[model samples]
Target: MTALRKTTTALISDAAPFAIRAERASDVAAREALLDACFGDNRHTRSCQRLRDGRAPAEGLALSAVRQGRVVGTVRLWHVSAGGIPALMLGPLAVEASSRQLGVGAALMDHALAAAKARGHRAVILLGDAPYYARFGFSAAKTGELSLPGAFERDRLLGRELCEGALDGAWGMIAPTGAPLPKTKASRARKALLVPRAA
Candidate 1:
């Protein structure tokens, strides 16, 4: 496997001076704060956020770049059905402005995609600059018929198939497919009581 598709621990030692790793719960605030600094408050109103809303990222796919123990970059992939095909929606990739020149963003992309492939994910789609993501194998050629819930530029809808042909027939709406959170015991009990008892 290529270095970018190897594992989460793989480091971009030459281009990036920081370490890339799986994101932890403790990194949430720092990550969110970093994203805000990079993308600003308007980020939540973007088209990609529709798929990420109220959904958890694919297990083991959220990643962060750290330097001196502080989060400087973040990227996450969410479980979604590209039309009818299983795929992951990559989004909200952001790196601190101060760290941009250090290649933290690219390194985070590599680490996250690698972890996704290792986890057996078949495809990944994103709404981003075609020119930038093209280097990572994303293209809009196959995503013409696919769309997001909110408005987005057509040419910006890009996808990359982890396995050959994974997205060949993928067409339609991109909707969240992440597992729903389990009901709490109290909620289950309440639901059970609400069911009418047979006479």
Candidate 2:
């Protein structure tokens, strides 16, 4: 299993798991740094990035696992059309190496799924190891007919239906259906500066 898919080891009885919470805007930098450390610099070029490019995650679905007030883990889900069925795409679940054995990854998965369900999302799709995600009910059984925007391992594309039968008959290419991420004020102002002045 990859670092992101690590099995929980026997945790110290007094050592509480990292606390999970909705990610704050302040976590933006730390989260990116953690993701880079976990997935390296080239992480943005992957197939899942295509799904997330220029989009916002599903409302309230981005979570962070914090320890000692430091963000140690992160997970986010984005809205997508799972082969024509409405679904969320989960990705880039990352935990700091120092916290791997504390069950941070599993906690993030559970919390993210719960939040997604509470928000009325029907299903979630992700590319990850089957053995690791299996405990959470993710499988390829319902995603056999779905595909990503770019190269991806066929077996790694997995889905879990939050609503039973959510994925029934879902097929074809999965595509992003989330709202576009809002442009930063600096970027928007830069664009305005570039506009031609009235004659």
Candidate 3:
């Protein structure tokens, strides 16, 4: 009965054109393939893998854009903690090369975020091109006390507050819920995107 739940239900009932619900486990393979095609081999460098390590968001929060039953775009939100404060982290958003500009990515994002908010997630974070995510109300959290794991351009790390003052007093390393430090160099680089704040 919460606003988020009501909104999410409404969104689902009014699914966008050419969009369909994504099954959590059933869609992983296709989603991964779509991500590979969209991001190339360097996808891991984007910090996507690390973002969802131990706290992958529920399957209901992951969505895909389909046409003729083929996934053309996808978006995923992960459970993460910023300074131990719970939040959803959005990323690895990808749209098929052939499907760019078709509103596929936007649709997926809208669906996933509404679901997260409905589930009581107070905020979401991402390291992405600002111009693209701004339409969703994401803004630079430069003054917000949260940090990523490795070296990253500070400006690109952004957040959206689903609830007012969600990021207030939140500072510290943003980490996967229960995972250890990344082992590979690529993962290390991606982890750095979540710069840790001084304790």
Candidate 4:
């Protein structure tokens, strides 16, 4: 058996500096900055972001890699519909530039996927480099007929069925299907402030 089991992973090696763990509320700012530095400001305009807008990530699937108490990597999987089939969307996996050499990205992927499967998720879809994701069992073979909300390189769309044949007959558009986030108090106040009072 490997050091990583099913639910979560925290790789500890004498040479490794970071540990993989479930993303915490306090990691938000650092994770966002790491994403921007890795993906640039236009990251939100990407096709996958459409599948995540106004939606919350699947429970217990978001992960972060921290080194010396600093968030050095991040990954999150959101719920989406693969045609009519329920699935999760894995994406925007980013590691701090300098920490990329520490294998943080791959560790984050492994931990997140294991957690998703442990939670009984059937399958996962992602738009990423087929070469890199292939090592994790993601492939374009089952996603050829699926479309994203915006333009994407066809070859980059991929899926991995956690359960045998989970993605069978999966086709058509991949749309956001995650639970909607409730309005936060700050958001409610901002919206109310934008409204003009009735005269």
lDDT of 3 by residue, 26-117 (tens): 56566767776777756666554666654535546777788667777788777788887787778788888777766777877888888888
Clashes of each: 0, 0, 9, 0
Go through the candidates in order and give each one's C-alpha lDDT.
0.83, 0.88, 0.73, 0.86
| Candidate 4 residue lDDT tens string, 30-65 | 776787788876887999988887777898988999
Judging by TM-score, tell me the better candidate of 3 and 4: 4
RMSD (Å) per prediction: 10.8, 9.8, 10.5, 7.9
lDDT: which candidate is best? 2
Q: How far off is residue 100 in model 4, in Å?
A: 1.1
Predicted structure 1: lDDT: 0.83
Give the higher-lDDT candidate: 1 or 3: 1
lDDT for predicted candidate 2 compared with the true structure: 0.88
Q: What is the C-alpha RMSD, rounded to one decimal, of candidate 1? A: 10.8
Give the worst 10-residue stretch by lDDT in candidate 1.
Answer: 185-194
